[model samples]
Target: MQTYEIWDSEYRFMTIVWDNAPIGSGALCTLCLQQLGWKKSTVYNAIRKMCEKGLIQNENATVRVLVPREQVQREESDAFLRRTFSGSLPGFLNAFLSGRTLSEKEAEELKKLIDAHRKEG
Candidate 1:
C-alpha cells in the first residue's frame, strides 16, 4: 500500500486545494497568501512539489486534485490508529473519551457509524 503521509503544512495546503480546486495558479497564490500567509513563491513551490508527488495536477496553469480529500483523511486516521493505539479502535476511543461524557445523540451517531462500516461475514 502506498503511504499518503503529508506534513502539517502540506495538509493545510491540500485542504485549501480540496476546498477550491481547478483554481488558477495565480488565484491559488492569492488564496494561499490570504489564508495561509504564504507568498507566491511558497505557493508555487508547494504546487511543484505536490504535483511531483502525484497528489495534485497543474494543467494549463490550473490546479486540480489527483488525490481526494477523504482518501487522505482515511489514511491519516488509519496511521494514527496504528501508531498511537496499535490499530485498536476501542482502545483509542477508551483513551479519547476517558473523562468525557457522550450525549445520547453522539453515542447513537457513533453506533450508526460503526454499524455502517462493520464487515459482514
Candidate 2:
C-alpha cells in the first residue's frame, strides 16, 4: 500500500475537519481554537499543507476532506502492523492481550469479526 503519511498533530487537525466537513475556513479555525486550542494561523497552516498533500481541500475559504478518516486509519494500522509485528496479526493480538482479559461478549464479537473476514477472503 502506498503511504499516506500524516503527522500526529496533522491527524488531530484532520479529525476536527472530518467531524465537520464542508466547513468554512473561518468556522474551522474557531473549532480548532475551541477544541485543540490552536490559533487561526496554525489552522490555516495545516489547511495549506494538507491541501497540498491531497488530504484535504480548501477553496473559496471553505475546507473539505479529500481523504476519508477510515482510509487513513487503515493505512496507519497496516504500517504499524508491518513495522511492529512483521505483519503478523496473531503476534500483535497476543502482545495486546497479554495482560488483559476479554469478556464473553467481547470474545464473541471478535470471533464473529474473524469469521466474517474469513468468509470474505
Our model 1 lands, by Cα RMSD against the true structure, at 11.0
Cα lDDT of model 1 by residue, 12-32, tens digit: 999999999989999999999
The residue-level lDDT of candidate 2 at 96 comes to 80
Candidate 1 yields a Cα-based lDDT of 0.84
101 in model 2: Cα distance from truth in Å? 38
lDDT at residue 111 of model 2 (Cα atoms): 100
Local accuracy by lDDT, each model: 0.84, 0.84
Backbone clashes in model 2: 0
Check candidate 2 and list the clashing pairs: none
Check candidate 1 and list the clashing pairs.
none
Residue 94 error for model 2, in Å?
36
* Runs of candidate 2 exceeding 4 Å displacement: 1-3, 73-121
Instruction: Single out the weakest 10-residue window by summed lDDT for candidate 2.
Output: 73-82
